[model samples]
Target: MNEITLPPVSEIDWSTWVPEQVATLMFILRNDEVLLIRKKRGLGAGKINGPGGRIEGDETPEECAIRETNEELLINPINTRFGGELFFHAEDMPRIHVHIYVATDFEGTPSETDEAIPIWFKLDQLPFDEMWDDDRIWLGHVLQGGTVEGYFTFIEERLIDQQVIFN
Candidate 1:
């Protein structure tokens, strides 16, 4: 009889498994146009979405939003207000804990960033067809100035399912 051999189990790297804290700003133009980014890479690459990024050390969510806006869009969001918050999880990617904000006023004109390109479109004309599948589920409502919460499941960057509750 031949003996069977199996590979030994390796311990997981907790650091690499830690969930990331992300922040974003939803800049609403006077014409109900919302600021979106065409990501240069990753799951939503080439897709239209919001302007924001990860929360750096010692920075609050609001601060992160402000910083990200300047860094990613070259604009200083004014009178920015908290709109909503979302917590997304999937087995394939790092957990995303995001805070959403709405800015009706800003200091500088919007511009592109290394990671994203800033673009504007009428709210009613949002290109859902070019955005992440999950955006169509919760983003529209959020832009209407409502608070919402949801859990999204994705399989290899494709949204498989989501459960959302609006307030």
Candidate 2:
């Protein structure tokens, strides 16, 4: 596999790097179905994941989550709660801090956008095999009303080590 080519971890100043390419991801759940997207372009394209993207300057993670949702899925996520955080340490990609959220509801119907195709799956039927490897680390916990925080390091897309906490 071709590696993502991120800056070396040792050079990353995590204390101040949270503003660098910070991202937000939102999962909207209803009944037993969870909304996901099959990205059509950019990072993680062709993979199954929730709707989200980079945080613009002066925008909070929550704002980014709502904005990305409206852009990608044409819905305004409602009752979004901060779920956890993911710190990415990878060789191929730059260090990233991603804020995660779970939306108990949303406004408008999900429609496909230029960036992704929205899809839904049963809570017990998530496509783990088609998502980022780290999804297996915290997805289930947050989906079940629990919270999660994960720090994952990778080399060439292969998981190197992981630390996760759930409550």
Candidate 3:
């Protein structure tokens, strides 16, 4: 297979970058465990990640987060709060901006759905190996209640560069 070529990270103008998709990622935290999903379809299919997707027309990021959680895991996330924002630029696709939220409570049980399967993991034992490379770099800070902003560049599925800032 031919390798895809991407512009170097330093050559991209982050200040003027526009995302083709605006998305949300909602993490449901309960005491020592956090809810994650094994995505079965769409963008990151087969990857383990938070429940989220592209935002619909006029929907606020928080609203999108709750809705996506319900749609993907059959649960309605409650007490959701903004956690951070992530900017992803991949060689083969348009840039994506993801707003992250953390929810402390939820209603209904998490169940398997067409798009994902719900799983709960300990805060300190997140399945980073089964997740995107960037998850390992910044997820810990978010779990510890630090707001973060990250910029990541990828060549297809492999991370090539990143910058993460905790607020």
Candidate 4:
């Protein structure tokens, strides 16, 4: 048998550790309206969300945000800024770490795509009832021009426990 030595636990920077799948979300907002999409397929199908998707190899979160926006909305997202991070854990699914960004500068009008249908709503008129369980709890903060960090736990699409903080 061979023996291996490991570094002290304190030497590890666990705070920066990331799970297998990394995702990015970008929200485009104007004075009183924010653009959203009705997802047609994939996780949270039929739910309303900002355009986003899994990050590909070697792609930065910001890069992933731009790519996802273009793919889903056919628009070029500009002046994007990192807004927050979300940690989601589900009993039957892999944990997901999402990097969220807010973009107010963009070109072209949004249109429906194979993945989702573009929609706009007055900020105060957002349809929280038709979004992911955690959205109603935390998304409002993001819409209010604040940063948010959330650790959410879910069981089969139902939120079990969550702690959301806004800056």
| lDDT string, candidate 4, 66-152, tens digits | 999999999988988888999876546667989999998899878889998999999999998888889988787887778898877
Model 1, position 167, has a per-residue lDDT of 84
Give the per-residue Cα lDDT of candidate 3 at 151.
90
**What is the lDDT, from 0 to 100, of the residue 115 in candidate 1?**
79
Task: Report RMSD (Å) for each prediction in the order shown.
Answer: 7.4, 3.3, 1.3, 7.1
Question: Per-residue alpha-carbon lDDT of model 1 for 37-128, expressed as tens digits?
Answer: 88887656788888778888889888888888888788888877787776555666766877888877888888877878988898898898
Clashes of 3: 0
lDDT score, candidate 3, position 68: 93
> What is the TM-score of each predicted model, taking all chains together?
0.82, 0.88, 0.95, 0.87
Ranking by lDDT: 3, 2, 4, 1
Give the backbone clash total of model 1: 0
Candidate 4 deviant stretches above 4 angstroms: 1-18
* Candidate 3, superposed: residue stretches over 4 Å from native: 1-3
How would the candidate models be sorted by TM-score, starting from the highest?
3, 2, 4, 1
Candidate models: Cα lDDT each = 0.73, 0.87, 0.91, 0.84
Candidate 4 all-Cα RMSD:
7.1
Reference-based lDDT, residue 99, model 3: 98
Q: Is candidate 2 or candidate 3 better by TM-score?
A: 3
Off-target runs (Cα >4 Å) in candidate 1 are: 1-18
lDDT of 3 by residue, 56-139 (tens): 999999999999999999999998788999999886876899999999999999999999999999998999999999999988
Error of 2 at 35 (Å): 0.1
Cα lDDT for residue 2, candidate 3:
80
